[model samples]
Target: MLKKLEAQPHPDDANPLLRLTNLDVTFTTSTGTVTAVREANLTIYPGQTVAIVGESGSGKSTTAAAIIGLLPGTGKVTSGSIEFDGADITHLSPKEWVAIRGSGIGMVPQDPMTNLNPVWRIGTQVKEALKANNVVPKSEIGQRVADVLEEAGLPDAERRAKQYPHEFSGGMRQRALIGIGMAANPKLLIADEPTSALDVTVQRRILDHLQVLTEEKGTAVLFITHDLGLAAERAEQLVVMHRGRVVESGPALEILQHPQHPYTKRLVSAAPSLASQRIEVAHEKGIAVTDEELTGSGAGSVSTSEIIRVENLVKEFDVRGAKGEAKILRAVDDVSFGVRSGTTLALVGESGSGKSTVANMVLNLIDPTSGKVFFKGEDLSTLNSKDLFKMRRKLQVVFQNPYGSLDPMYSIFRVVEEPLRVHNIGSKKERVNKVVDLLDRVALPRSVMRRYPNELSGGQRQRVAIARALALDPEVVVLDEAVSALDVLVQNQILLLLNDLQADLGLTYLFITHDLAVVRLIADDVVVMEKGKIVEAAPSDQLFDDPQKEYTRELIDAVPGRKIQLAL
Candidate 1:
């Protein structure tokens, strides 16, 4: 259980723009009742940037939803009052909420993948928001849409405006949603995980834009995020939540430097952005963690084998032009790289840069337009169906979105055991035993075996996916943004788990990610890609210390909290 912070009094002269007093939120589910937010109190002064930081299911989003009066099914604020602009608004009808939603309080939702409508074009969606909120005249809505999209960091805004949500990549879709939310520039803007899907450079640009809005327009911003470094860097004030309660709330830098709560200390220590400089802190405390432990294979195992190799990989797609002329679009342009046995090779790039395409080709899920993939010195294309099926046991993949990757209907136990049962590896009892062991390896409790994916947090669901991937004891695991959706502490734990698994099982890893801060922690070798081409390749240390390419330097510089150093 998380201990609560000591009660503090609010100053009478400091008039906050938004204040919640003794807020208690509860939900009525089919099984029973659940308290999402218990006696939560928070305040945001005018034009001040405040962040609610927590892991998934910690009630950060619930508080935001309560403020917006948009709680999902059977959720309600049971007690206390929410005062906004000196008006008590604890219980408002749906009709009254409609008035405050768009013009008064703008919201950037959490999930970009499912937030936007699939049928509508991006520009149409933005224009609709503008028209509804009356942010701009109807005659100027078209130009305003383009302006907002460009401001949100989407290149070629005019062309992208016509594209549907499905046509854009995940990061692009997120930028579109951001454009919609910031279109009106409301007095109180609630941004929930706004930069979670963006690359480092784009994320920096977006956050900077928000800061400018706060400075110039007096837009009191409420940011909801799981990133500790981002919260510390972007917000002036911070509120840390754990298990549906606010554990700490104070100045961001003070909380980060001298954490009063145990949870806050864990967040500061486990954060990769801050952990980069805490090597000595780990040692002074008698901690044994070293950069070498994060690397794959022992010193001698590096000379033993090369598991996966890609030579001059090229992938192209033929798109018909407006005049029916064929145009060839090069997705992966003659990229060459190799993953040594029991080591991690990270493919880092922006969205739609062919990272996922390259991973798919390596997994043999999609055939490359050209080039060859050799697994254990065996060419993948030469294999017949039987050989391919046999080779599959040697290769596996864990995707980014755990909720999307997992089947909602299946229990955790069934999800892990299915792979074993399909392979016909053992009896039913043996499969059950294998699942229990896999869960243990992933640090998940046995009680979670009966729970469904929908009932678990993002981190818990990812653990279940990891357990399933290890069920086959594969030699290579392609982790594509596996921990991107988790909080800092959870991401740290997952990286450590991967390192340990590689040491014990001799597993080779092909890691695909956009976060360079994460790459610095877990990757042994880094291959930087731009426009589907390899621009830089070096060891993690060399690349971070002195990046060769201009693009690589920009990516490193854009990492949040590059200036601040954390200490105990």
Candidate 2:
């Protein structure tokens, strides 16, 4: 609602590059119809960064798709006008859109793997992308491709361009995707969750490139993501969406630093990577949580009743070099920790620290060459398949991307019923009843029972996934980056839900994450991990009050916006 009034025209649009007037996107289903975008009006200037922020179901990406004429087959822009520099381009046929998609507008899809042809060479694909937009003469295509790759900040651009997509790591793949997007230098770039899959360092590098390009070429950006921190770091303008509607829209700083909306406030409070800085500050000032504050803040009711314990856990992996011999990469080396019943033990670390490996071993998904995992004082490794299956119900997990974890083909009902069906623990009637009850507990409607994963938003899918994980009534829930991919507001809601569930169900948590902000909010005890080893372990209060390890201090220092004095 804010930007609609006073924002200046973007420098790149040349002349009001594109505009969406009273846009309405809808879909017609077999049983009924749904409106995905409601009177969504927008005016994007060339060379400006317009951040579309929202929870999973916020209709942000759908709006981007509509602008690009890439809506799903079942969906349609029933009533709206999409004008490119004053030309009404809303209803263009697919063939007509083909000419415009790459030349006039480019899209960097959310998942790099989804857009790229895994089998093709990266250079060849990039060359094709450039050629499709008629960027250069056929003779100069190869050189042009090299330039684009270098501009994208890839190492050994020429050599990397020759490699296949699979050869690139997650960060590299995203950069390669950016290379393709920049190939033709389209007037507008629609980046759907471009940085969601990247580490912070990589994310910062990529955003730097995007900023330079915008300033140099005046390319307007429509960045779609669930990360509010990222949106603040990059975009000048902001648009917040929820339940397929815009709840707030304004300058990025105003919305992020001084949000008036309740939803927006919650999102800011829940940003784990950012909010976790509270713990570091305490350590810096050597301030301990007082008895009254600890009790009031949730530490008073907690006790050290170890449900899971790891003693001198060691995990290693083999890597091969040109010599054709293997080198051991110690992923989890001599790590040790304990989880108390009805409390969370947070694992905080950087990428490649063996946090996930530790989680997998605890889940018994992977075998540890050495070390012992004691569950309820029993050796986990000694359990038989039958007993292991039973043990699984006592410990469950929630992954990073809820959408990817859930099957797109199955309805919410079937997805939630999976644990019951797998264990064959209940009758058909009993399972159905449980499914309905779990859905209600997760705050999802019964109407979603027949709805598929694709039909739900990011937050809704996560809720559905949470319900599924809770189906077995597990005592210990392993949330592996569970709230990492969500927008600030939705992430906070889920965290609160986890807290409530812990109180109601008497649950224990082995929360593995790179997000320190989460450690401040939910962790009863904290484990600082590095390269698969526990560098520090203490009660949350003590750890935050006085962190002794240098690595712990570094992790505390790495959080973005922690030192920045923000208004809100």
Candidate 3:
């Protein structure tokens, strides 16, 4: 039996800083009225840190949006009262919301790409927030921006301030968003999946700064995320939401140790932390992995023969700098690796580490400046345009953002069948049948075939993308950050599906991601990259158990839930 973590005592008589009573939120959609949150009740004390965790479409984000009065797509609170600091502000006007938007309630939205305006410079955006809130004097705004950026772990803050969103990497953009969200030092901070795109080391730094908000500034934090293990480690209290209702709420660790709700139990079991623990124990016991231990697949028996080999791969691009001077930017330099047949080779690194650049080269999406790429011992450079087009059918790719990758104009049936249509392989009826089978393989229902990309959730969109990738019956698949945007449970499902597919079809995978925990769950070999160089390359067990490089060790230690052992 797992021991329960002792819950910290709270002052029962103290007034709550924020309280939601019988909160019912609904959205007016084309189909009909949809209830997002039903009779929800929650309370947060001043300076307290609480987490709301669940899979996508579970209403955690919806609840956070409601608190800030920024709910999307005609969502409104009905027959509910929201009291903040003893003030009933449930139905605040737009002008009224402006007064509390920054100074009283700060929000760090998910997806830095869409959150930050691309045309504006980093400092300009931060200064706009500070000026709007009147948090500092006009003369002191510049220095304040630097201070917040530095606090968010951006080095050389002055130089970085002038850079636009496009110039910054994914991690750097997230840091900028954090700096903007924390500029006014609001009373309450709502961080919605802020660090989901960041690597472990950067994630640790951002999380540490959030801890400072509660400890030093007496600011309460309402964290919304899909990683249950992360919520268990960071927050004092936890609320698990399933299908828009709170299924369980209690002390964070207590919920993990002894979850009463079936959904909560499923979440606890599906966490990558528990999977890593199982891998660690198996390695400690010197137990050879069996087929059952490897997600009902032959993932454990991946052969050692090379399927795709990259040698001295170098890619460079010409860029015009601030002064209109041409500069050669080396994206991938002298990097080399090989993916074994019927196995997963994970390329692990932070943003701008050239992981995606390498994947692009392997897929022949871009021509390399130098070096050689061999697909099944045949040089990619040697193939003509006709042969290259034919060879591409044997190689497929699933990208990070499925919504962006899939065309919105196309329905689920069109999206999955387009590849088949382009290949000229099947009749109209045959292609329709193939689309249904592919959707079934990815666990999507037949009814979804009529829906557009916007009609489905994030996980569902990713499944459609996977189904499309497998439509051509490719020999190799490149999954680039494929499951990073998903919650833990969805990520586990996708990883398991990939494993089963690899086992059944003997497919090869080139997995690229920043998450080391997920890499441990599904990867056969790991290649650690930094600044367009291979820092370390080893088997999954060796990389996790006995990493030889200091950078690798730092990344492993920075995993969010590494401190606590999950119950198996």
Tens-place lDDT per residue, model 2, 20-81, is 87788998998888999988877777677788887676799999999989999798998878
Please, what's the RMSD in Å of model 1?
Answer: 4.8
Over the stretch 292-369, how does candidate 3's per-residue lDDT look in tens digits?
345423244458789899999999888766234447778898999999888888899988889999999999999999
Prediction 1 TM-score vs. true: 0.88
Off by over 4 Å in 3: 1-7, 30-32, 93-96, 158-163, 281-299, 322-326, 446-448
Which candidate model has the greater TM-score, 1 or 3? 3
Give Cα distance to truth, residue 99, candidate 3, Å. 3.8
Q: What is the C-alpha lDDT of each candidate?
A: 0.83, 0.80, 0.86
Task: Assess the local accuracy of residue 511 in candidate 1 as a C-alpha lDDT between 0 and 100.
Answer: 95
Q: In terms of lDDT, which candidate is strongest?
A: 3
Clashes of each: 0, 6, 0
Better-scoring candidate (TM-score), 2 or 3: 3
Off by over 4 Å in 2: 1-14, 31-34, 74-78, 86-88, 91-99, 257-302, 318-329, 382-393, 400-474, 485-489, 534-564
The per-residue C-alpha lDDT of model 2 at residue 395 equals 90
The residue-by-residue lDDT of candidate 1 on 118-233, one tens digit each, is: 99999999998888888888788889999989877799999999999999876678778877877887778899998887888878876776666546667788999888878887
Which ten-residue region of model 3 has the weakest summed lDDT?
Answer: 1-10
